[model samples]
Structures are given as structure tokens and as C-alpha cells.
Target: MVGVSSARDRISLRGIRVTAHHGVFDFEREQGQEFVIDVEARLDLAPAASGDELAATVHYGELAQEVADAVRNDPVDLIETVAERIAAVVLAHEAVEETTVTVHKPQAPIAVPFDDVAVTIVRGRA
Candidate 1:
């Protein structure tokens, strides 16, 4: 005989805005832009559920702080690269089984007015 049990795998955060100089053109970099970051993660919950400890699971607050830290410190030319970097950082955590990062850039230097430009990527432990 065998027994089946449920497990949880979800972590998410949203609306993290960071104003930074990130772009290809000199003017765009000088002027800066509004970046909105959204992050989601998935991991096994057995350790956390059993011990009620943070060390056993992915800490969403810490992940958000890391995202803010990366944007504030690094100067990248593209949101795609930003998303990739964020995903990499999240996946680096041993407890994180998978992660997704979305970086939104509004008020770009383009002549046209649009909602926003963004990139979303998903990464998993390999």
C-alpha cells in the first residue's frame, strides 16, 4: 500500500519599482527610467512545513531585496539581461527549485507612448 500527500510550491512578489539609469542610449541612461519587477518562485515545502523555519524555504523578502540590490548596483542596457540576472540569482539559492522574473521598463526614450516594456523569464534547477 501507498499513501499520497500534498505539497506546496509557490512564492510571489510584485510592484517593486526602482528608478535607475539603464539603457543603450546615452540620454536614456542619463535620464533614467522606472523599473517594475515582479518575481515568483517554486520550491519544496516539506522542510519548512516540518520545522517552521525560514532556512528550509525560499525567502521572498530576501529575494526582493536582492532584486532591488542588483538594479541599484548594476547598469545594464536591456531588461532582458536584467531578467536573466535576477532569475540566475534566485535559482542560485539551494532551496529554490524554480524561479521567474519579470522586469518592466516604463517611460522609455521611445517617441511613442506605450504602457510599458517588459521581459519575463523562467528558470529551474538543473
Candidate 2:
């Protein structure tokens, strides 16, 4: 098991929209659709806050772009995989100790009407 950190500080980026080709069906892969991603990263903020330095903190705007890029990359069959990819990206930041990622598929291929479908994952450093 990985040792858990008790960090309370976090930076959350929500509702990041991206159009990507990812699904089980042929049409889904060929036509593509939109996906919404939410990411929450946990870290120690005291260094950045006390020093008032951008370098000490994770650049969220850059993070968002990286998340979007991950989503738009290689197509996968499950939103779970996408969520995992997003988590990996967030954890790549040296300051991020833990991350929770949510990948939302609003237009999922369900017979009945639904608002959305999503997969959420929480990851922490070892």
C-alpha cells in the first residue's frame, strides 16, 4: 500500500469539454463526441502561498490544456481509462500528492434517456 498524505489543500478544475473519438461502437469511433472532465489535485500550498510564487504552484491553465490533450489522444473503449489517463497527468506535477478524476459522457449510448454517465477515480503517490 502507498503511504497516504494528509494534505488538505487542493486545486480543482471542472467541466473541461473536449470532443474525442472514444467508445465501443463503430459510429462512436468514427463520428466522435464530446466529453467533460473534472480534476481535483491535492498538494501542500504553504510554499506557494507564503512565497507568492507561481513556480511553487501548479499552473492550472496549463494543467487544463494537458488534460484536454490526454482526452483527445488515443481513443479508448471505456471512460475509466480516460479517467486514469487524466489522473496520471495530474500526478505528473511534482506538487500534486493526490488526484481525483472524473470523466463524464453525457451522450452515452443508452436506450433510455439520461443526463450523463461518468467514471471517477482517486489516485495517490506511492
Candidate 2 residue spans exceeding 4 A from truth: 1-6
Badly placed stretches (over 4 Å) of model 1 are: 1-8
Cα lDDT of model 2 by residue, 71-99, tens digit: 99999999999999999999999899999
Alpha-carbon lDDT, every model: 0.81, 0.93
RMSD values, in order shown:
2.8, 4.4
Q: Give me the overall lDDT of model 2.
A: 0.93
- TM-score to true structure, per model: 0.86, 0.94
lDDT (Cα, tens digit) per residue for candidate 1, span 27-116: 768878789999888777776877899888877788888888777667889888888888888888887778889998877776877888
